[model samples]
Target: MEWYLKVLKNYFGFSGRARRKEYWMFVLISTVISIVLSLVDLGIGTFDEETGSGLLSTIYGLAVLIPTIAVSFRRLHDTNHSAWWLLIVLIPFLGALFLLIVFCFDSKEDNQYGPNPKAIPDDNAEIEA
Candidate 1:
């Protein structure tokens, strides 16, 4: 999907705002790939019993860690919050819950982060009269 690729293309971009769709799509695609890679590692016997994670999965996770955090930071910006808010996840149970609530809401219109991604027209999309 375009959303998933767009997130990856942005790579370490932590500035601009990202819509909920962009964030969720990236999460979904990453989860699916991780599951498949884990299964492949299991079939090849490269899965680590000690860490309970496969080598391929571990590698993939490391490769995407920056992009994942960048997207989260942008998502928070979309909600009109600073990237510092992500530190809340370090707290007990309440932190993650708060972020979940934050990410669920729609983006604020033209916030300081950037334009509303939801309203931007895709360059590849053809507009017909």
Candidate 2:
């Protein structure tokens, strides 16, 4: 839950690395929310021919889009890749495949972009008084 909120707080931020837990947790929670909302929309027959509102479904998708892109870009940053790579997903099937590969790959340790986000800070390091 902390991770989910952290990601949301950084919703529009795309300049830093995100650890696997942060990225995956955000994805998991968002997916669960989407599923639950979808179920409710279906149950209410929001799109029923007689009388249904499409507004709720549209809002749901819009709500998730920002975090989705932010996480994906941060995931790429974790791999030391430029966030611009996200544009690749605009292509056909290949784009999504590429993103999947990137998201699944382990973060590079000490890459030019930055240090591995998965590494824990040294407890013995001196702190300024």
Candidate 3:
């Protein structure tokens, strides 16, 4: 939940590196929220069978669209890849597979993108005794 909130707080931030936990946590939580919204829309008859999305779900997707891209870009930066690498998603199955593999790669040492996210201390972390 902290990771998800951190990403949302960054909102349009795309210039820094994103740790894998940050990126994946946002994905996981957002996916769960979308599912819940879809169920709500279904119960309210707002879900459209044609597009397979509901009013709330659609709105939520649009709301997070930019943030999602921003996080992906930052994740790429963490892996030492340019944001342009995201274009590979247009290549069908292979592109997504390639990106999935890349996203799983360990974060590189401080690169042109910025310092390694893992090296930065979290402001919200509890102080050690």
Candidate 4:
């Protein structure tokens, strides 16, 4: 929850790196909330079968659309990639698969994008032989 809220607090932030945990946690929670709102809209008869979108769901999606994109951009930054790479999503099927792979890659420590969000303390003792 903290991770999700942190992302929301920086709702329009796209200049920093986001840890895998923060990105994934926000996605997980948002998905769960969407599902719940969909059910509510269905009960209220505000769901449209034609478009497969409910009033509540649509409203929620619109509200968070920018934040979602912002997080995705930050996630890409964490991998040391440029935000322009997001255009790959327009390439049809391969685009999403490629992005999935990219987002799953381990964060590159202190890259041009920014510092690694998963950085460990340098003060920790090393396992010297």
Candidate 5:
């Protein structure tokens, strides 16, 4: 939940590096919310079976579009890749698979993007003995 909120707080931040935890957690929470919203839309008769999507989810998707792109850009940057690499999704199945693999790659030591997020301690984290 913290990771999700962190990403949202940086909603338009497309220039920094996003650690794997930040990227994946945001994806996980967003997916769960979309599913719940879809179910709610179905119960309210706002779901369109033909299109296989619901009004609430559609609206939610639109609301997250920019943030999604921004995060993807940052994630790619984290891996030392240009944000333009995100366009690889347009190449069909292989492209998406490639992107997924790229996302999974461990963060490279301070590259063109910025310092490694993993090396930076969280500002709100508590110190331990």
Candidate 6:
């Protein structure tokens, strides 16, 4: 999907705002890939205790982790909040809950962060001939 690729292209970019569609699509695709990679690694005996995770698995996680954090931060930016809010996840319980609420909630309209991502486009000029 274009949304998924858009996020990947901006992989390390922590600026700008990301809509719910973009963020959720990336998560969905990443999760499916991780599942498939883990299964393949298991088949090839890459699940050995020595390395813990196979090369593919490690790569898969890193690939997803980078985008996940980046998008999450961007999502926070959409709420007019600093990316540092991500550090809340480091706290035991309360912090995690707070961050979850922030990420799951919709963005406020026209805040300092940016315009509401879900706002409908104006079609007033389109004459209904």
Q: Which candidate is the best by lDDT?
A: 3
Candidate 6 or 3, higher lDDT: 3
Q: After superposition, how far is residue 113 of candidate 1 from its true place, in Å?
A: 0.8
- Model 1 misplaced regions, further than 4 Å: 124-129
| Highest-scoring model, TM-score | 3
Query: Compared with the true structure, what per-residue lDDT tens digits does model 1 show for residues 1-129?
Result: 777889889998999898898899899999999999999999999999899999999999999999999999999999999999999999999999999999998975898999998789875356321
lDDT of 2 by residue, 1-129 (tens): 667787788879877787777788888887787777767777877655445434566587797789778888888898778999999999999999998888877875876656777675632234312
User: Candidate 3 at 75: error in angstroms?
Assistant: 0.1
* Full-model lDDT for every candidate: 0.91, 0.76, 0.93, 0.87, 0.91, 0.78
- Give the lDDT of residue 47 in candidate 6: 68
Mark the regions of model 3 whose C-alpha exceeds 4 Å error after superposition: 127-129
What 10-residue stretch in candidate 5 is worst by lDDT?
Answer: 120-129
Model 5: residues >4 Å from true position, as ranges?
A: 127-129
Best-to-worst ranking by TM-score? 3, 5, 1, 4, 6, 2
Give the per-residue lDDT digits (tens) of candidate 3, residues 1-129.
Answer: 888999999999989899898889999999999999999999999999999999999999999999999999999999999999999999999999999998888875899999988888886466322
Off by over 4 Å in 6: 50-52, 120-129
TM, every model? 0.92, 0.78, 0.94, 0.89, 0.93, 0.79
- Whole-structure CA lDDT of model 1: 0.91
After superposition on all CA atoms, what RMSD does each candidate show versus the true structure? 2.3, 5.7, 1.8, 5.0, 1.9, 5.1
Writing each residue's lDDT as its tens digit, candidate 4 over 6-118 gives 88999899998887877888999999999999999999999999999999999999988998899999999998899988889999999999998888888757988767776
For candidate 5, report its TM-score. 0.93
lDDT per residue (tens digit) for residues 27-88 in model 6: 78878888788788889887656866776888879876888899988888887789999898
